[model samples]
Target: MPNTPTTYPAGLSRREVVAWRNGIFTIFALCGIGIASWMARTPAVKAALDVSTAEMGILIFAIAIGSILGLLLSSHLLARFGAIAVMSACFVVAPVGLVVAGLAVTLGQLYWVAFAGLAIFGVGMATCDVAMNLSGAVNERILGRTIMPVFHAFFSFGTMIGAGLGALAELLHVSIALQAGIVSAVMFAVGLLAVRMTQSETVLHVPDETDAAAPDGWRSRLAIWKDPRTLLIGLIVLGMAFAEGSANDWLSLAAVEGHGVDRPTGAVVFGIFVTAMTLGRLTGPRVLDRYGRVPVLRASAVLAALGLLIFIFVPVLWIAIVGVVLWGLGSALGFPTGMSAAADDPRTAAARVSAVATIGYCAFLVGPPLIGFLGEHFGLLHALLLVLVLIVVAGVASGSARDRTKTL
Candidate 1:
């Protein structure tokens, strides 16, 4: 981190504004498709490769590693190269990764392809997320009203489409390879379409400046660590990310394992979860505006805890639906709000947020497989219990963050 006097103009070039907005949605749409399809067909994939839960857990790491690589480097890379170039490039790789994963056979290959695809997917997502947040915050500064949550609605919509598409593909018995090719082609097309919308240049860049890289330097990120409030916010975000990760990756397995739901039905539970989450997010801004992100988070945490408790103790499949919905709604705001809390400012806020987010989402990358492994050895019910404990930690993070976010 060398800060490059990062600031957007009083107004962007019309082209930049259009490009940023459109590109953000484009990536979100693609991600929703990939994630939904994966979740929906988790059992099929597992069966095809003859993977036990532990093996599946190991394979999920590929996704996490890619996410870590993407987030940790995205800041400096974008700062050095600019947003559109990075975003467009990452988006292009997303589908290619999907195709590779679809064709993977051995557990090792699944891990490689899934992680590689997810990494590119993660990179594409990170790029879009950061750019829009940066752009949205800039818009808020210039226009003086909130617009982020609404923009995020598109992401929710994308998730819905992705999940639906996945379920449909599965019902049709589309080969994973063929379905993935479909996904990849779509992603590529979207990326190519998106490229036309990006700002060829940025206001955030420092002109006539050739920047030198630091070798042993963690100095840029180090600044955030030294600030107690910043450190706390980062931890809070990490907790939230962890909680959300468990929910996204494990909820289906929990339903299947703990409640004895069939594979197809269990996968659909995750769709229900995402659907509830997307609905919550789409409506969350109104609530956040009326009260605040912190209160919303605390309530969400308690709600999520209750949901998990239901999944564990209830034992009836019919009753578990309510629990999953509660879980979904509970989780909806944690990640996004945590990101907002981390950034919430102009200067280095974006970098700090991304850094915190990188650390936070690593939980998502690492958590699922670990849970899967734990479930393999112990039992999924026990894994769900562990997640409940983490949810409590996430709630605490949310409460701790409220004061700091206000300052930011």
Candidate 2:
């Protein structure tokens, strides 16, 4: 049986709960905006650095390495400093790194500067990612409802906005450094409001019973990696991360280099994908509530696989757009849903989420460099065929996401 929290902190007014929820949503959105802003400008960054596809992959890999390091450390950090403090610190760090990355492209030692900036950005993002998700999981227990997907939906909305702005900036010939600096300033200002709202909540004092029973120190944290179900859940999320991360990191590049679209047009295509994902997440909760996790996830995997095949095989532009929509909808639910499944037991939620996220993030580590190498040989469109196989693996593991009671 899961160790659900027995009680919430007492005497929170409904309004206060709403404010806290909004804060979580805003933080998620800001993180998304920060990431998407960098992603949308990737082609420009690559151009500025004058790097080959394979070399660009190496630069991207640095970010993933830093992210993996951050994920490895996040559980310890959250336990020591608490989610609010970690999140606030990371929120500041991520945008600053982005600003540095933007400015780095203008330097003579472009590769080194870009690599350093991206590494910092990745660490900040990985840490902030865990903190926000943990907060969302805690809030879900208090609300007695599934709100995780909604929070992720806000992230997609932010991506849409970021991508749109990036497309406009590309069209206007704005310098990447100036664009990133401007976005960073806005994110920092709004992030302050998000931090203030989350800080006003008094619920952090309530502790889950599982945390009490679980052994202290690294043993309890290390133990999560041994759970068969948790590992399976991690694989399921790994598939989703590959499907989504590939798009974030490579979609525009593929569109431009493979399909011969202009940069602004490629950004627009990326925007379409984020918009479709936003729609999926906005509506996923009702479907998940009625159908449950396994069925919805299995269906999503199949849909995503189909979309990948269509997008890769079809040469027509409009048809590819349709495929992008399907791909986005199909990939939207898996990551957040996996996070919810990992957090089913509140006591070990932080550790379990960190493990799952760490495993899932391997996709980022592997996908970009692999795609870049394959794109060097097979072409970007053909390289994407790799994701279809991962999607199939995810479908087989979807059952791991079933409610514990149902599986029992």
Candidate 3:
């Protein structure tokens, strides 16, 4: 008689699924966690000190300063502590930063504390972001299909949920300090518990020859970054990071300063934007697989551009929401698409991806502050128009990448 065939389970184990789910939760929480303080108290923070836009710009930069420091330090931290401990550290540190920001009595104290907290938060988050993406990219390759968009979609979902929850907290007259503390508790509990729930595929899964198609060595891997096609992909990532970070840092302020929307309504701006973004990313792969990468990227860029223009040029709140939804849809695939392309392409594969990620995230470190300055020096409405120009540039870059890689 023939030997009986072996069988596998039809669905993922509760544990296997949780690892993916928890990591996504942590990423999403990062986006929405700090905003509760900023969104609820921005006006108060501004009013308490009677500070001008330039001063406010400086304060905002302080947070970025912390984030930059975090970026610089992340690789080391990840190397020393490993991903689980590092994520756990961030989950703890970020909330403490929120608590400090909420309790500080003076603006300068607020600014300095916010900076220090963000530095710590950024370290955890920046490391988490890279490790998570690297893991997702490898998993996609191993699975022989696309999963990056779905991972990102969940991140978007976390942002939406966090933002909405923050808005609701503020609306209920929860003090800013109390609101921030509440979020801190939630993120901490979630993140700490998640440590056990998530596992790294890197440890469990090794690649086959097709998976490790490139030669093995630091030199061979590093050579990927030397390729021009890979650098072009980095440019696409840079543009998208600039646009997305700008929206994250400034969208609410735009609603308040430009359109005269009240704070709670303004706070909801990113929530709506991110909610739409989550939906778009969730559905994006089907479109990507069918249409190919180029047309979808071009369409996304155009949509992002159009949304920014509508938000900047038009005054109606509902109309602006429509624009944000469109922009979210347009910009949804930027990071995932760029990374996937970098990894798939023969010229660079992984190393170029590491380079692209490094440079692209560097853009994130500076992008938001630059937006704050522009909003300070230039009119808020006028400043936002710049996002369209950047998105257009990204469109060109991604579109060209698709064309060039096809030729390769």
lDDT, model 2: 0.83
Candidate 3 TM-score versus the reference = 0.72
lDDT of residue 313 for candidate 3: 84
Those runs of model 2 whose alpha carbons end farther than 4 Å from true positions after fitting are 1-9, 43-56, 106-111, 168-175, 199-216, 250-271, 312-322, 375-382, 405-408
Whole-model lDDT, candidate 1? 0.66
Q: lDDT (CA) for every model shown?
A: 0.66, 0.83, 0.65
lDDT winner among the candidates?
Answer: 2
Name model 1 segments beyond 4 Å from true.
1-9, 12-22, 38-59, 99-143, 147-153, 167-178, 195-218, 260-268, 315-319, 376-378, 399-408
The deviation in Å at residue 401 for candidate 3 is 6.4
Model 1 lDDT tens row, 1-408: 112223346466555565565665565556666666666677777788777887775665565556666777767665566556666676676666667778774234455556466556656666556654554444433333334555555667766777677778878988777887887787778766765564433344333222214442345544555666566666666665666678777777788888888889988888788778778877876777677767888888898889878877898877788988898888777766666666554445556666666666667766766887889998887877777777787777665456342474
Candidate number with greatest TM-score: 2
Which regions of candidate 3 fall more than 4 Å away from where they truly are? 1-22, 25-27, 34-39, 44-56, 76-82, 103-114, 168-180, 201-230, 249-272, 306-324, 342-354, 362-365, 368-382, 399-408
Model 1 clashing-pair count: 3
lDDT tens readout by residue for model 2, 51-127: 89889878877778779888998877776677788888887887888888888886564788878888988899899
Question: If both were scored by lDDT, which would come out higher, candidate 1 or candidate 3?
Answer: 1
Clashing pairs in 1: 19-197, 62-115, 63-115
